[model samples]
Target: MRGPASLQGRLSLWLTLGAVLLWAVAAAWTAVHLRHEMDEVFDSALEEAGQRLLPLAVRDIIGREEDDSPDQGVATLREHDEYFTYVVRDAEGQVLLRSHRADLGVFPPFSGIGFADTATHRVYSDAALRGTITISVAEPLAHRWDVAREALIGLALPLTLIVPASLFGVWAAVRAAMAPIRRFRAGIEARGGGDLSPIPAEGLPSEFQPNARAVNLLLDRLRRALEAERSFTANSAHELRTPVAGALAQVQRLIVEAPDEDTRSRARQVEAALQRLARLSEKLMQLARAEGGRLQAETPVDIAPILRILVADMGRDAGGRLEVSLPDAAVIAPIDPDAFAILARNLIENAMRHGAQDATVRVSLSPDGVLRVVNAGPVVPPEQLARVSRPFERGATDAQGSGLGLAIVEAIATGTDGRLELTSPATGRADGFEAKFATNRIETK
Candidate 1:
């Protein structure tokens, strides 16, 4: 069977995906903004350095041209292991000074003060020294990219750790929120077979209260409907019993008093019809009682004696066609004595009524609280087997039956916390029907 859908799992998946997307967008924006700000800061430092060095280059060239060459002027500019390199050129396009890190030939001859790019470095030029000298500051492009990568890693690493922790918290919160639903399900599951009472609504979450109230309303309607049905069946059956019995008696008297054979035969037919009606009415009463939601007795009752009594009673009419197998020891179970008797009688009677005339009916009760009845007959179709336990349904159309036998037995089984199973071609019998009842509690001694 397919597994149940998980609301928590779906919610968690969406939440985690949304969180990841949000984090990714935020991280991307932060990286972009950080790189822009770093570029601005570094560019400003480059411009300031070029302006400062412009005036110094003019003073050094005019005062010490004899002793300080362009290379010596460049050596004097190295103050720290910073990323910038500089070159100073005069108006005549002669190199007046150059930093050690500067690629001498790669630095293009200056045209005006601005920024430019070579193969490896970004260069910014200034011509603010005596309005003639130009100083260019250049740095490797790789340096700026390295700094941006370090800054992004520092920002993203902590967030990566936090995402998993946040996902865990979301899972826990979802489970906690769903606890009320689980409790509501458990309450419904704990009800007894006949419990159609309104569900309790207190202590439930506000969001679930409306659903709970609706369920309670449905239960209330079902309870009323079932009560009406049971009451009507019981009252109608009771009211009809006296008249039916009186009619059967009158018909029998008519049969006895009839002078002609034809009249006597007609009276016997009428008596049979009256007898079928009487049996139908009686079964209706038994079905109502079985389904009346009455609490069964908790005391243990031995089923062996009941079986023996039922077998003997049925055997009178069954002649030599009935067989019974009962365990030597008593098989005791918690059940209502009246209900058990009704359930057993219906099963045995059904088997006898529908079974082949020459076929023997077998009744057996095991120590494990299983009561089984089997009888030789044509195999009942599998499709019809399920419906046979419902009211007014029969295995064969020609069979003389009220059709409430199996239904009444099923009702009693459910009320007593027992199970009823029906099978065609009864175990070890090629062409027969079997009915098995398994009680929840059984004791053998």
Candidate 2:
């Protein structure tokens, strides 16, 4: 099966991804804009330098023909200037004055008066000395790229560190915001069947208050419905007890006073039927009590005496078919005395009724608060066992039962926070049924 997914984890993941994506887009836009702005500033500087060299080139041109040699004045401008070079040409397109670093022997052939590009450099040409002189200022494309790259790196460095830190902050905030939900879940889980009070909405976030209120409304409805059902069951069982007992007493009298053998036999059958009805009524009362709520007062009760009394009562009917194995000392557990007795009685009675006629039924209590009733009988199928704990369900259709025996026991166990385990064919006995009760705490004294 796939594992459960977490809301907090998914929210954090998507939030972080969104933040990273936004940051990347912002950074890319900044880089593009920064590169464009740097190119403008560098290009403007190139044009200004060419204008300053125009006057110097005019002076050099006038003295050039007299000297018939290249000027040395432009040589000093080349020093410590790796990113820019300049070439001044006459109107005839012959080189007039050039920087020492301008290694290209021929000046750029003029087509117009603006920026142009050769294979290695970007050239800006301007007419100076009243259009008599042409000045070209060239910068290598490699050097221009280096300047723009440095500006882009300076702009991006801080965001690279900020993005990871921002994501971490978002995760922490999300977890802290979800703390109230965790508290709400824990409060609900801690409640028992007896706790039907509405959950308090105080101190919860506004976003969660509606959910809390809705749950409280549901709990209120459930408590009222359960109260009504319990009231009906208790009143009905109480009302039937007196009438059922009166009828059973009348049947017993009929059996004793019948004048004919057939009449007496028929009266005896009626008595048996009345007895079964009485048992069913009693079980219904017990089930209602168990389901009403948790025990009001829990007291340490010794189970040895109770178990012995139950086995003795059952043995009268079971004769030699009953067996008992009690712990040497009393087993003490926190439980309701009436509830425990009812649970044990139902289990022993079920064993006697369903077990093979000649097979021995054994009732045993361990020092650790495990009470077990085992009897030789057909094993209950696994599929049926899963559902047999429900009311009015028996191991076999032919078995005689009110079908509330195991259901009552299960309810009692749940009220005391105990457990009931059923196994068909008790260990080492292939044709036996075993029912075990495990209380929450057990003490032997």
Candidate 3:
């Protein structure tokens, strides 16, 4: 059979089992020893009774002044169950005196002095007056068995209470001893992939301290590596931004100055390529910001104004294709304004870039801090929709842009303990795409 699955249960079970086994062994040994001692005491009692009764029986026979051939029974003043009985006999094997309840059949032929065992009784015989007068004391074996049984029960009764108490004590001690490990596990689980702070290894037992130290060391290495990567990304993007913008401006100038149609068209293509590079670099910087440190503000603030400004800028560029709706009351939240803006911008841009060119994009923020951006477009397949949020993964649409939009929004949501969900077909719409962000960690009022 399988033992307990958990460490605490196994420890308590085995300890309790060991204690019960030891108790059982001790009790058995004690009972055997007790029975031996009891036998010695009972035998001594029988011997003493025979010796003391022999003289008194001789006196009674002599004082009777009657030459008796048949047995003479001693009279009893009260009625009781006599466990021990005795008989006085002559050398000729004639019973001269007997106890009130003595059965002559139980007394065997006396061979010599000391203890003897009959089938039904333990007989002790003694003689006086040169072996002519003899007395035998017989005690029933059943009476001895009864006494032994009661003594054995006395040794066992306390176990009923002791067993449960021992189990409880074992469980309590094991739980207390494992408390530090439990705390360590809770600390690790609470990190949830964002927080890489090392877990403290204090108060752990010697055997478990090494494991705790190893886990903390691993977390430290991961934290350093991630920080370095984010720093590299931010640096590369920041360095590329100025040159890419300058290149795009030069290409635009060349497109206007080119002498032939083919040359002008080629310059226009170069300008588009440079513009793509600049946007890609910008997306990379946003991704770095989204993946780095804290994303929440020190206190809650109304983020409605930031949303309005972004919608106006994006709408003006899109030729009035963007539609926005903001709550009348404050959309109070702890999310940092910059992070929220980046997230909102990415969602809005992704919808515009992927949706039909002339279709309207709907952006709205509910009173409870849920941002929904829906665009009229072809429904994305289930399998393709699943991976669209990954870096560098874009839809099959021919629109040109960096694919870090959804990825950035996802990172910000994860860091801020919010959720971002995308649907291929927008809820309550026949054919569209929807991105919903829930910052439930906000004040609704």
Among these predictions, the greatest TM-score belongs to 3
TM-score of 3: 0.82
TM-score for each predicted model, relative to the true structure = 0.77, 0.76, 0.82
Candidate 3, residue 159: Cα displacement in angstroms equals 3.3
**Model 1 stretches astray by more than 4 angstroms:** 1-10, 44-69, 72-120, 124-135, 149-168, 185-193, 205-207, 253-264, 295-317, 320-337, 365-370, 413-419, 439-445
lDDT, candidate 3, 1-445, per-residue tens: 9999999999999999999989999999999999999999999999989888998998888777655655889999999989889999989888989999999999998788988897889999989889898999999999999999999999998888879999999999999999998999999987744689988778999999889989989998998999999999999999999898888888888988899999999998888888888888999999999888678889988888889999988887888888889988988999999999999999999999899888999999999899999999899999889999999988888988788999999999998899999997999998999999988687877
The lDDT per prediction is 0.85, 0.81, 0.91
lDDT tens digits, residue span 359-388, model 2: 888888988989999988788899998888
Model 2 regions more than 4 Å off: 1-10, 45-82, 85-121, 125-137, 140-168, 187-193, 205-208, 296-337, 362-372, 416-418, 425-429, 436-445
Give residue 124's error in model 1 in angstroms: 4.1
TM-score ranking, high to low: 3, 1, 2
Task: Tell me how many clashing residue pairs each candidate has.
Answer: 1, 1, 0
Which of 2 and 3 is the better model by lDDT?
Answer: 3
TM-score of 2: 0.76
Which segments of model 3 are wrong by more than 4 Å?
Answer: 65-69, 72-82, 92-106, 118-121, 140-142, 301-333, 355-382, 422-436, 439-443
> What RMSD does model 1 have?
4.9
The Cα RMSD of model 2 versus the native structure comes to 4.9
